[model samples]
Target: MLRGFTPPYTPDGRSSLVPAPPWHYAGTVLSMACPTEPAAAARFLPQGFGRATGRIIAHVCEWQATTDGWELLDPVNAQYREFILLVEAERDGAAVNFCPMIWVDQDISLIRGWLQGWPKKLGQVWMTRSYGLDHPAAAPLRAGTRMGASLAVKDRRLAEAAVTLDGGEGQSLGFLAGPTYGLVGAPSIIGEPTAGALRLVLPGITGRVAGPMASGTAELRFFDAPRDELAALRPTGPAVAAIGNVAITVTGATDMGVVAG
Candidate 1:
């Protein structure tokens, strides 16, 4: 006998809420390329993907982003750094970047990145800004600029990189522009740890190469890393490097597939 009681529901009883606006980020990206063994690189890849060659793309970047949806309001949340170890691989007959390790300086970024299938973890990352000075000798003492980033966990330095930005190079960005995929571990129905592949999709991304190409060296200390997964990137030599600025919208993400336990 229900009388004079109305449920708080619409005619269709469907929720009508709009998704949050995309975040905007502006920053500098310093990149380097290294060669690694095919077998060694394969370990970091998932099913349906194959190593393109033996080249690994490593980069360190510093970014300033808007705090639209971040949980923390601290200044650290507005700015952060990232160190990525990427391997070139083929997926569905096309080349793509397979990210194995990604380190960030903030917890909110780490959590959001993990949900997108990025192998993100908390680490101390730093890089130098562009600077130059005139010298009495040494070719006008014009050192393009020196920048470096290191990943440390609990006072242990896992990786380090040093790069010098000298001048520009006539290289195409299309070759480097592609989709990225990562393996994300999650709890299964039985409460056992399971892993899956997540494909990150960025839409309306627009930007250009802002600075001249760069040359750098990278060193990885597997013994120091927490999981030592980055050891597979045995960087034998340098490939190509560049500096650029970008503005893009993080549309969303999709679960590509599940990894076998």
Candidate 2:
């Protein structure tokens, strides 16, 4: 039987409610700066935070990992896709990514994300790569190699994009490092017969970019989902789209405070 601080195990013993184990990711990422409706975006911002300096950015990527915690060889946690809608926001005069929506297919990921206030949900995600047999292994981001991904819920597709990393400049991951804010609603400890309290969670993780694609063109399709926060991503002009491999570690989280009513 599972004991200690490990999350409860399933009756079938197939899965558990534990966070993802430390892992490495090798994949391609596409980022674009898009136009955002200030009013609509503000709805996702937490208290004491304001809009960021630049336009909102959208990130779509597909990743294959050694493992997400149960075990290194576990197939269930080895691969997944991610779609992130990030807006620039300021907290205490510090810039950060105000992640409004993030979708993944794994359950453990969902739990861990919620614990950190990532607003993560389960969704169908996919990415594809085009390569030839003679392609040089040393240069994974070869010219003419194309990649694309889509984020969908049920039968509805919310976002889709395809890009070819023909050429681009090198970029540092430092530009991407900043505070990430998430909002989570949990049962009130006071036990009052009222709506559960919402808390803003900030998780701390260490990661770095491994590869870089300086420039690329992306064909994107975004739909409106009135009930979903992803609808806030409105790309006005295409920003520099790049490709890269990243490694990240999920350390822990910090609870900021309960949202004032």
lDDT to native, each model: 0.59, 0.65
User: Which predicted model would earn the best TM-score?
Assistant: 2
> On residues 1-261, what C-alpha lDDT tens digit does candidate 2 reach at each position?
444224565445444555344544556666655556666666667666676555566677666555444345666666667777777776677767777788888776677667777788888887664333656443356666666778898677888877666655735322255677777777654766655888877776666556545556666667877566575566555554566666666566778788752
Stretches of model 2 off by over 4 angstroms after superposition: 1-15, 19-27, 65-70, 130-145, 170-175, 188-195, 207-209
- Encode model 1's per-residue lDDT on 48-100: one tens digit a residue: 56656677776677876653645235556567888777778876787778777
True-structure Cα RMSD, model 1: 7.7
What's the TM for model 2?
0.79
- Assess candidate 2 and give its lDDT: 0.65
